[model samples]
Target: MKWNSSHKAAGQHVHQPGDKHAHAAGDGHNHTHGGIFGKNTELIFSLICGGLIGIGFGLSFIDGIPPLVSMIFYITAYFFGGYFTAKEAAQTIARGGFEIDFLMFVAAIGAAILGSWVEGALLLFLFSLGHALEHFAMEKARKSIAALTELAPKTALRKDGNGTNEVPIEALRKGDVIVVRPNTKIAADGVVVKGSSSVNQAPITGESIPVDKEPAPEGSFKIEETGKLDDKYRVFAGTINGNDLLEIQVSKEASDSTLSRLVQLVNEAQTQKSPTQQFTDRFERFFVPAVLILVVLLCFAFLVVDETFSTSFYRAMSVLVAASPCALAISTPSAVLSGVARAARAGVLIKGGRPLEDLGSLTAIAFDKTGTLTEGKPKLTKIMPLKTDVTEVQLLKIVVAVETLSDHPIAKAIVRDGKEKLGGEDLPAAHDMEAVLGKGIKAALGNDAIFAGNLALFESLDESKPSAEIVAVVRKAEQEGHTTMLIRRNQEYIGMIAVMDTPRAEAKGALEALQREGIRKMIMLTGDNQAVAEAIAAQTGITEARGGLLPEQKVEAVTQLAQQEGKVAMVGDGVNDAPAMARSTVGIAMGAAGSDVALETADIALMGDKLSLLPFAIGLSRHAKKIIQQNLIVSLGMVAILIPLTILGIATIGPAVVAHEGSTLIVVFNALRLLAYQGK
Candidate 1:
């Protein structure tokens, strides 16, 4: 074949349009079926090629072996090393496209024509080895992401009336009861209806400790209740159930399981590019083709300067091998793939490359106060009865009557305490109950008009106004950050109750960690009044607190922060945080396992309802960012030095190929290091 005639006619890269190239910088192509060996084809074939090359090189130094036989050994090694590269290069050329592998094939053929058979064989062998090792390393990272599918068992034990049948997870429907035995994964997200046990939730929440699982509130299973435990009644798919038995009533179909959605998002995230990667892609688009043209121009330029065409061609080939952007192309994708896989395993879902890099660049953060810095549950902190005749317990009973019929958070808190205090005692229910907007409620307690609400409920009655002493106490409670509600019965001031949402135990430490990580500011926003917001802010390490803010006001506060500080991130409890989160540079949703809105809306999600993971996510992102910069510096630096040296005849074809392929291998291995990263 007249290779030069065809090369002149083509003048472009040779690659099929739809070919799935898997490696970074586009040199690593396709995560296809393993080559000759099982799941180790590329590496194994490279080793075999290396063995033949070593034997061929050794035969030249020996006397007995004929030169013809020695040539045969080199030819066999070339066949093994160049087979896939040639196939891909041929396909690329046929499709009217060009690739780095195609350039590599031309360089190898150039070496063969120059009668440097050993040098050419070595070049092909080393080039193939780099691609093979890169393919293997990237597969390891990709498999880490794919491993999410394996966490759940293929089938679940569906409980029938007489016995249990093993059914595929796809067949499981909502409300279907399934029995989970010891040391097995829970097949669906559901509530436990029977039995008790401890379940390890690391796969779903990254929590290493096992949590105790209890029966549901209305579950008919007979077992002694042991007060309250966090997430006691809930069991999610992909978590390991400990010793003892549990029968779960599925809350969602298998397709909607937490693990399924997590896997789906992660797989989609791999396709999303970061800014650095996008820049590299644009650079490679022009760079690869330019290198080919430069090599062709340099070949003729060298021929005019040198005495022989062979010498000029060899130098151009050396420059061609040196100029290949093997390392530059693979750097970002290698690091990104590894980092994403590591994060998913730890239960931090960084949506894609853009958000992963954005997280590392955030300067300030705004937090939604409810269910974020503070435990969302309101507690009945104090109960004070105003009437001289009504004791605290007697007043609680009257309050419980109206509260029991309501499902408001404050009502639930008051009812739980009242029911616990008055042991097994029946109380009269409030009839003709009606709620007052933003103030309180009014009800008929056996025809005696009972009004139990805030101070506004008594504003219309100057004749039934409370004494000065009672009003003073209620006003004092408000300053201390308590949400106060006053009760009145038939124009008489009965009492006042205070409820407060306490700060989470780990909130302060998490905020401090963010400050240490170079986050300049942290703000808390909520609907509570300024005093209550400030109280919680002081308990935590928030830089500023804005309260009495409606949903729209929260968005305004986030926007103001973004203008003042570059790259502001909004951390929210998932649902209400959407508006404010949209205003910030990045939206972070915590407690994703429970919120569909959080998983779909936030750029990043802390799967568990833990504030501690926020600091970890940012720390891990910074580490990944650092690794990416290091890889770029090394890859570009090698190409810069090697290209000039090869063209100047200071380095030959063998050494140039060695250095180029060596740097490519180094960057890939460096990216895989993200798997070992641990955030405190």
Candidate 2:
């Protein structure tokens, strides 16, 4: 196509009503899926067109038929590099929308009008190349989310009465049993009815460790519904099952599965623009029109200075090329995408660019007591046998027997401790076990009746029987924030087991790192009593503690802290804490590998139990913000300096085009540097 004819036809920029109607009617166009060449076809075509242009420019310098060949090459280059961009510009111009592409098209046309066909063609080639590179970067960043969908199985082995049949994941309904064979990915969220093996949950949770999975609890699993992580009986889709036959009853539909929700979160996050991005978009709307008007004014000023119209127009074109906002427009998104992708690889899910930016500005952080600063599992930290008559080993055996049937965290800790201490000694069975709802458990061991519970339970049975030593030990355990259990056999005081949710090994170091990153305050918020909260806080180096907080109270505490500190982040992992997380500037969920609520509610999610990634995530976010600022400064600064040079006649179209495109390339590479970021 001839450039003049095509340019005039393309100038009708607006989409006709008929075109919209055709699109609504599902016309044969596949905008989302370009034929066999795929979405990057334009980029590929542009690169080829750019190469042809280079050949054509080389041919232009030769004599005879080579110049004729160069003409052919230039025409092909114009069709490949400038066709689509000019079409878009014309459509926008028809709608009275003067976008950056229109400014670029106008500049290239002016270069051609000044008898600089090579310069104009080169301008299109470089512009298309930059556009392709930016699109490729964004595509790579978003592929992380797309990868999630590829990890899950599309079909499942549904179990029948005697035989199993293969079915699509969507066909499997809630409560439908599915058989997962060894080394297979789970098809849906479900509870294992029969199985014993370690399942790799890295796909969903970002954890490197494979968690042990067992059959569903024989007792009431709902009694201690702490979170998905606490419920080891459950498994998620996209996770790999180990070398064991697992009979799993699907609990969620295909679309409602954890992997689906994760992909949804990432997709939504990508669409939600950050503040810097929003500003850049708004600025570009005016920036392009302003540049066009400025170029026109520059042409007029040159004419008044007695310059020829061609000379003035050429200078005006140079200014337009130099002052284009392409670099500035792409600065924030490139850095944001890179930073988010890097964080995702490290098992930190930053919901969007907005949260990624907010994380860098965090002045204070509030951590939930149970699962944030400490390991959510309570462990037997202290074993005190107050009864001098009974052996420590004997007392532990009784403690284990009495608490064996309970699924409480502390009870499990006691059983674990007992098994370790017993050294293969089979404990006598506790017959006729009875539990007091909020107090303790009572069971019969041989001829003796064992009572195991709290001080309240001990006092209710016989308050006056407590000796001074027993009272002191109980008080001391409570003071240290341990969950104490009193033991009595045959109506006589025996011993007590003190359990505390111990601090995670990385908690202290993570907190220290946060302080080094300029975090001024770190507070612990918990439903646990003040003593327990303070104990964990002291161990983790938190600045303060707020205990005995209800779900709403935690929100209130977060709000108050945010008011005091400018920006505050709340970290939690339970469904109850979702409200509080929603109230904070940035809500971070800990060990959110399996919980759907935690994943949806928090702005940022840590996939594993390690707290060390918290500081690393913060540091990465700050670095991302810094990189974006640097990119913008470099891009805008280059344009600022280049525009003046063009106006003063010190620079021409060739140098201006090179400098403009060169700055954009530099800005893009600078943002890509975040992909290689390594946290200290």
Each prediction's RMSD over C-alphas, in Å, is: 13.7, 11.0
lDDT tens digits, residue span 224-338, model 2: 2412434468888888887678988888889987667655533322322245655664665788888888888987875479888778877888887788666775676567668
State TM-scores per candidate: 0.59, 0.65
RMSD of 2: 11.0
Every candidate's lDDT: 0.69, 0.70
Q: After superposition, how far is residue 677 of candidate 1 from its true place, in Å?
A: 2.7
Q: Indicate the worst ten consecutive residues by lDDT in candidate 2.
A: 1-10
Candidate 1 local lDDT, 541-615, one digit each (tens): 798988766445666677677667756787876334544543455667776432343334456777777888888
Q: Worst 10-residue stretch by lDDT in candidate 1?
A: 1-10
Q: Which candidate number maximizes TM-score?
A: 2
